[model samples]
Target: MKIKIVENEQQLQDAYTVRCEVFVEEQGVPEELEIDDLENEAIHFAGYDDEKPVAASRMRLVDGYGKMERICILKDYRGKSYGKELLLFMEQVAKEKGIDKSKLNAQTQAEAFYQKLGYTTISGEFMDAGIPHITMTKNL
Candidate 1:
């Protein structure tokens, strides 16, 4: 699998499709919230398997802060470290864009995943879209 920054409409669609499958369909996030206005401004990344998108994520550079969101991987592609690769790439993008810190709201179930990736939990547990979530951050 190869990971690349999405630069065209097609890749963006692939990213959205993956997100819809994982977030909207599986996680029950409202479609309205699953697809956000941030798409246009965020830097998108997709992991592809010979031209087919398998995993995806987005990074936003807002006020010199990198915020990661919409991270998803196809069910068949999970447990393969693609998520970690996507995040490392996002971190690189953040550094390249001069972002000093990166943050994300991780689903409670995935808190350990982000923690293993060097993100520190910084907020109390809260409900988001009817699911538990916690804020996490890491200095770039």
Candidate 2:
């Protein structure tokens, strides 16, 4: 698997496709909520299996810290470390931009996954798009 920074419309669309499969189709997140206004301002990453896009993540600077969002991997591609690779790549991007901290709202079911990546929950459970979520943060 290889990860690339989305640099063009095609790349962005590929990232969106993977996200749609994971978030909208698999998890039932509303389409309107899954695609948001931040795409234009955020840095997006797409992870590929050969030439097929299989995972994606997005990050943006928010109040001097890196805010990561919309991380997803195709169901067929899960359990292969693609999610962790995409996450670490995002953190490296943040660190390169002088961001020492990163934050994300992790689904409650996936909180342990983020914790394994060195993030700690900072907020109580809350509803996001009808799914339980908790804010998590990590220092880069």
Which candidate number maximizes TM-score?
Answer: 2
Best by lDDT: 2
Q: How well does candidate 2 match the true structure in TM-score terms?
A: 0.98
State the C-alpha lDDT per candidate.
0.89, 0.94
Off by over 4 Å in 2: none
Tens digits of per-residue lDDT, candidate 2, 37-134, equal 88889999999999999999899999987999999999888999999999999999999999999999999999999999999999999999999999
Residues forming the 10-long window of minimal summed lDDT in candidate 1: 56-65
